[model samples]
Target: MSKTMKISESLIEIAKPYAEAQHRSVPKQIEHWARLGKAAEENPELSIVFIQNSILALAEEKAGMATPYSFGE
Candidate 1:
């Protein structure tokens, strides 16, 4: 369910490098930023680093790349 919308050329240009670096499409890069911004706005007490790391950890878990952490092992 994707829709076409107008976006600034400068924004697209800014997203290009980040998109490439993250191995995502330009639209996905913008979406990622939007998601982070939304999370930050909703969770004012949470740091951006924590939010980003949490998202990464969730992704890793979903992709079956995460392992259980041992306690004091």
Candidate 2:
């Protein structure tokens, strides 16, 4: 369920390269940024790098790419 909305040209320009690089549509790239911002706001103590890695880890898990972690004895 998506709706049409107006966004700044500057934002579109900024998102274009990132969207292409990430293999996501411009809207999806913006959505990903929004999600990152939301998580950052909610967990002020967490670094952006950590948040990004966590998101990637979750995505990998959802896509069945995660493996069990083995701790060294």
Candidate 3:
């Protein structure tokens, strides 16, 4: 279970509309933003497209679509 916490009304208001539009709950929407914010902070040089591609690559790997790397070819 996740810990419960309080957030400002302003933040809730900002999340609510987007959450509804995205079909996510307010908390889920906030968590998604937090994850992206952390990823952006960690990889300052990476573009959003790069980040998304990286995520897709990871998903494909988990689904057994990735091949082993060849160091020399």
Candidate 4:
């Protein structure tokens, strides 16, 4: 069985620029980080940047606040 969840439209909007900057689609970006998260659980060398950034992005969206970070800017 596969579990599912909903993502905020605001979060999607906020991540758009970053995803575009990385030349990745939003789904691909999320998958990339999901893999990173899994790998981080098994490896110590992976940076925590994605974890922190994703959390902050989600929190900002939930609170109806603007994102403070942007890639390639």
TM-score of each: 0.86, 0.88, 0.68, 0.46
Model 2 TM-score, all chains together:
0.88
Between candidates 1 and 4, name the one with more favorable TM-score.
1
Residue 44 shift from truth in candidate 4, angstroms: 2.6
Question: lDDT, candidate 3, residue 54?
Answer: 84
**lDDT sort, best first:** 2, 1, 3, 4
> Residue 5 error for model 2, in Å?
1.9
What C-alpha RMSD separates each model from the true structure? 1.3, 1.3, 3.5, 14.5
* Model 3 per-residue lDDT tens digits across residues 1-73: 8897999999999999999998999998998788777878899999877776787688899999999999988
Candidate topping TM-score:
2
lDDT per residue as tens, model 1, 2-70: 788999999999999999999999999999999999999999999999999999999999999999999
Global lDDT of each candidate: 0.97, 0.98, 0.88, 0.76
- Which segments of candidate 3 are over 4 A away from where they belong? 56-73
Q: After superposition, how far is residue 26 of candidate 3 from its true place, in Å?
A: 0.5
Q: How many backbone clashes does candidate 3 have?
A: 0
Off by over 4 Å in 1: none
Sum up the clashes in candidate 1.
0
